[model samples]
Target: MEILSFVAAIAVGFVILSWSADRLIEVASTLASRLGMSILTIGMTIVAFGTSAPELLVSSVAALDGSAGIAIGNALGSNIINIGLVLALCGVIYPLVVSRRIITRELPLLGLVVAFSLALMLDGDLSQTDGFILAGALVAYCYYLARHSGGDSEDDEEVVILSISTARAVVESLVLLALLMGSSKLLVWGASELARSFGISEVIIGLTVIAFGTSLPEMAAALASARKGLFDLVMATVIGSNIFNLLGVLAFPGILSGGLKIDSLVIQRDGLAMAGLTAALAIIVVSSLSMGNTDKASGSTLSLRRAACSYIPRYKSAILLACFAGYMTILGISALA
Candidate 1:
């Protein structure tokens, strides 16, 4: 009966999650197009952060509720899922053709964050010092990305401005963003309550259930773009979300929490899982190139067949799922023991 209840909750949650995610992407993309913003910027500021908002909101609420473990776990688990499951699935669906810029910039920063996160967790808790350090890195990273974004071309920025006036664009963007935010809140509420009504642990619920819940927009957006042959948009949505997870999802909760705390075991396990997955992603990128598969070597430039071979060893998602399984196994065993 308990298992049945959990399954039922998950089914409903998945439906709501998918519906909400579609709405989010629809509104965000429409607004971005209306406001003269690029899809990349939309993915970075609006869509990316919007999708991650659930994790941020849940973590903040968990921290305030004094369930710091849930807060920390949600943040860490979501990050792992964001990079591993989300990116891996995106790649599998349509190989993530790297931009030379992404190869030298975004990938390296991701690796650094993975390393830095592990170093911070070398201590039992993520103290204020750690929080500030992480936050500072985030700011620096954003600054770098802004400078190197290679955006703001005369034609790119100018094209949108001519289509819509600034005042109208601002109003439309705000209204759309508000609707997106409100729906997301409803989705999160439905998810948490449904999870509790079942017998699922909040951590597991957060890792698998809610993580996938929030990622729905990216999944849908990417697939739609893939079908439409808008491959750059797909890559932007996938890679841009990764950047947002680190900057917004991970950073927001720590600042709001006053301090972030995790069990040493949680830190070690989740940290290793994230790092291992990130390393696998890098290997997939490099190896795809070495094998004369330039499709994934740069953005939207690879052939379909080569792009398919881009994610060899596919250990990012597999390892994360395995580690999650192992973590849950230990949890279940410990509880039963």
Candidate 2:
């Protein structure tokens, strides 16, 4: 009964989490638009940060609770899920077009960030110094993106600006943020209890259950974006979320706890898997760039015209799904052992 209660709590928490995140993004986007922010600015800062709020809150709470395993696991696991599961699934649904800017800038930045994170964790602990470094990188990356994002694109026109008053929007944003933080606490608590009941390590629970649950918002967004043929948005969201997870979400735990200890399995298994996935994404983007399928539309703006043959083929997406399956299999075996 106790286990069932925890399971139920997780389910409820996830539903609230997804709903609240979507609401937060909507209100925040509208607020940004009202404040005379460009669509690029809104997308890069408000929407990106809103989607990552759950992960950030959960990791912080876990760290405060002294569950370093869950804290670190949530961060690494979310990155893997974002790429391996979320983006791969998006590709399968509709082959994503690779943009030159994303390939030349964001992907490489992600690679370097992942490498930096791994180096920091090499000592089997994520110290406050490491946290500060990661956090600093996140801020720098966001600033770089803002400066280079260029003016509004065609997609920006599609954003629906809400007609609410500024004071109301501010109040709503605060309410949504409070709900998100509360739901995050419920998720972490439920996950920890569930792990205890099942005799599984908190890390495993974090990696599988909590990771998947927290990622529901991304999955929903990806699928919806794919259905609407907003492939670039889907790609941007995944890439942005992963970077935020590593640098922003992960940093909080280390900073709050002074130093969060990492399990060997986390570094050896999950860390390598994350790095490999990041590399694969980079390879995909770079290969697409070299295919001569893209065109320079304006200064610093490259337009990707979808060919009859997609740069990200369905077969490649299948392979990503296969990799995801293999990783899950390894995790299952380890949990049982």
Candidate 3:
């Protein structure tokens, strides 16, 4: 009976998490647009913010509770799951299309960020210095994006129009942010209790269950956007969510705990899998760009950039899902061992 209560808490937490995350994305995007930001980049910004909200809160809470495994696992595991499982499953259903901007711009940025994260963790210690570095990088990256990403509209669209009032958006953002934080705490507590009860290592529980739970928002957003023929949104959201996962979500343990010794398997098996999958995705995106049916749009590089686009076919989706299956098999075997 007591165990069932933990499970019930997790279930309830997930429900609130999904709803609150979705609302937060909407309000935040509206607020950004109201603040004169371009609509082109708002989806990536707010959707990632909304999806990563749970991971940030849950990991911070886990770290404060002295669960280092859950903290790191939730961050790296979500990156693996975001690419391998959630995005792969969506692509399998309806192959996603992305712009050349993603190929040349976003993909490289992601690689740079992932490499930085792994470099900091290579010594098996996530130091306070490393945490501060990542947080600072996140701020710098956002500023870069704000200045460069959609600057083509620098002339006419200086003041973007949004329907919502600034005051209302602020209130809604606060309320949704609070709900997301509360649900995250509930979910983490329940997951920790179950991990102890089942005699499962916190690392395994964090990798398998809690990672998937926090990723629920991403999965939901991807599927909905895919159904609406918004394949670009689907792809961008995945990349953005994973980026924030590494930066904001992963920083919690190092920041709050001052420093924590990384588990062996975390830096060995799981971290390797994450880095490999990330590299594979980048290769796939670039290859797709190279093969895209593009004609020269103009003499200018910027002209050609805006004109290039491609889609992930069902075959590519199948390949990604196969990789995902292989990864899960490894995790399952490790758990049993």
Candidate 4:
């Protein structure tokens, strides 16, 4: 097939994948609720994981297909995009702010998950043992979140409860699951083909094309939340997606492939970059607008109209974007090598 044909397949795959993941998550959450799970629990666990369904499904397929580099890269690359792309872009277009609640909760949990996952992979092997540990961590993290979230979320954050019959919901969920699987397979095939046709490594393809593609939903969600200054939703959307990426998406390669051997550059370069960026996000999450601010906008030029610590300032947003650009450059150089 021509390159454009491959690109078209990937584009269609991402659209279908996003739609299927959303419907499936809603149906799954409803089923969970029927099984006695709380709304807060559903929001924290199902919704968060569902948002990352693209990455998780993609990685799982890559692992199963023996394309472990793409699996690993999707996991790490998506996390980088979440912080450096999605979060930064949101801050740039809106009066973004950091929430104290995020600083105390989701942010730290994300940091812990990233740190643990990196430590396990430092040996350059994504082994089943590593997968087990990460999976256990994910389970423990979910338990913590579910227990702490209480019975309901009374905050400004809204959880939509769908009114639907269980039998119909189950049927709809099964259909969405099939679509999700098919789309993921299509995306993986297109991405692998594109990588081979262009002489690009799977890791680079996974990091740039597939990573950004998987993160599109996140960028949309974060920007929407930032537009309204909804701190909890913004943080939850990004942080929650990221946490699951590390634990769930990354773990798939290890478990499914029975311990795949990864590229050294993954640990030496991409892995460290991911770790550093997470640390940067944690630091930025606690900072307020008092640190620095640009002058107000004039003559239709854009500038910060609000300076709030509980909100991110323009300069910090710029920093995050810079980090993203620098990392992309690194990926470019590595691909050429």
Which consecutive 10 residues in model 3 have the weakest lDDT in total? 151-160
Runs of candidate 2 with Cα error greater than 4 angstroms are 1-41, 152-154, 157-192, 289-311
Reference-based TM-score, model 1:
0.72
lDDT of 1: 0.57
lDDT by residue (tens digit), candidate 1, 158-274: 122224555654565555444444544555556666766667765566655565555555565565554443444555566666556655566656666777766776766666766
Q: Give RMSD to native, each candidate.
A: 5.6, 4.7, 5.0, 5.7
Ranking by lDDT: 3, 2, 4, 1
Judging by lDDT against the true structure, name the best candidate: 3
lDDT minimum window of 10 residues, candidate 2: 295-304
Which is the winner by lDDT between candidate 3 and candidate 4?
3
Residue 28's lDDT within candidate 2 is 59
Q: Best by TM-score, which number? A: 3
Task: Give all TM-scores, in the order shown.
Answer: 0.72, 0.81, 0.82, 0.77
Q: List lDDT for all candidates, in order.
A: 0.57, 0.73, 0.74, 0.72
Clash total of candidate 2: 0
Ranking of all candidate structures by their TM-score, best first: 3, 2, 4, 1
lDDT of 3 by residue, 75-182 (tens): 998899889988888878876666666677777888899889988899998988889888988898788777764523211132323478989987887787677667
Q: Model 4 TM-score?
A: 0.77
Q: In candidate 4, which residue pairs clash?
A: 96-312, 97-311, 97-312, 98-310, 98-311, 288-309
- CA displacement after TM-score superposition, residue 124 of candidate 4 (Å): 2.0
